[model samples]
Target: MIQETYPMTVGGEEVLSERELLAGVEDGLMMDSTDSVRYIILHCSATRCDRDYTVEQLLHDHRARGFRTIGYHFYVRRDGTVSQHRRLLEVGAHCRPFNRCSIGVCYEGGLDAEGHPADTLTPEQTDRLERLLLKLLRTFPKAQLRGHRDMPGSVPKACPCLDCRNVFRAIL
Candidate 1:
């Protein structure tokens, strides 16, 4: 099997591949302490696969919804660029009621071309999401990985559009 590589930018420097990202995670340079964290909830932007959702659009959309900023702690783009929109220690507005003790990770796309719920995670997104979750796990050993829909009190919606358990089965 061939090893797929993708570009990533962490802290302003461009990381050439997933290998380098893993190395940084191993070095514990990319994550902050989150002793209060009990869950790492995965989400999606609920956008069609053909559309591009930029950071500015996300901020604007969230702001329009009365959010102070992007609610998720991290936002992973289709090309695998992970943005730290909120700090690890900060309480996110994503996943209500559990925001104070959870880290919200949202991927870019979740809808198919016709605008229905589907797992539209690009290869780059899959890799980046996995690595990001791994790093978070290492930083907060007790934290459990969960889908937004899996949490109690979540409304009936396909926010993430996939079963994180099966997608990240290797690491989980």
Candidate 2:
């Protein structure tokens, strides 16, 4: 089931697409046996759109912050490359409190050149994100999608810098 439909290059090395990683989930081989997922939380790296944040940098940053690995289940690069850093069934460390019942999908940018919060999602990212969300909805039909800042008890900060509700209001 690991079709090489989407080709991607990570750090000058060719890597398989996120689709290959999700094949298990697609076939029911990978799923939360307890069905604890209640939310699909979206986040952003909060890096400037002008800068490139590679998956390696993300892993390093998270590990430096005491995280065992990147907290997000999927990391979408600015080029629309989706990298599955964690398993779908594994509880993410992306958002506090909601990690136990949520899947975290993160994009690479969320700030402008001035470091101000802004929706810097590239056209490719927007397209891929919507496609990914559609697939996720197929798997977790009951999960509610929300932006990182929109979650209850979230700190007052613009981590994602976009209104996920409005972005996918028509689709969801």
Pick by lDDT: which candidate is best? Answer: 1
Cα lDDT tens digits, model 1, 1-172, are 4436557566665666665554333222223447778999999999899999999999998766556568788999999999998877777778877776888899999999999999999999999999999999888887999999999989846879999889999888
What would the TM-scores of all predictions be?
A: 0.79, 0.79
Q: Which stretches of candidate 1 lie over 4 Å from their true place?
A: 1-33
Error of 1 at 53 (Å): 0.8
lDDT of each: 0.82, 0.79
Q: Cα deviation of 56 in candidate 1 (Å)?
A: 0.4
Query: Candidate 1's C-alpha lDDT?
Result: 0.82
lDDT tens per residue, model 2, 1-172: 4445546553343435554333212221234543677788999998998999999999888766545468788999999999997788777777777777788899999999999999999999999999998778777767888999988789847978999989877668
Clashing residue pairs for model 1: none
RMSD to true structure for each model, in Å = 13.8, 10.9
How well does candidate 1 match the true structure in TM-score terms? 0.79
Model 2 bad stretches (over 4 Å): 1-34
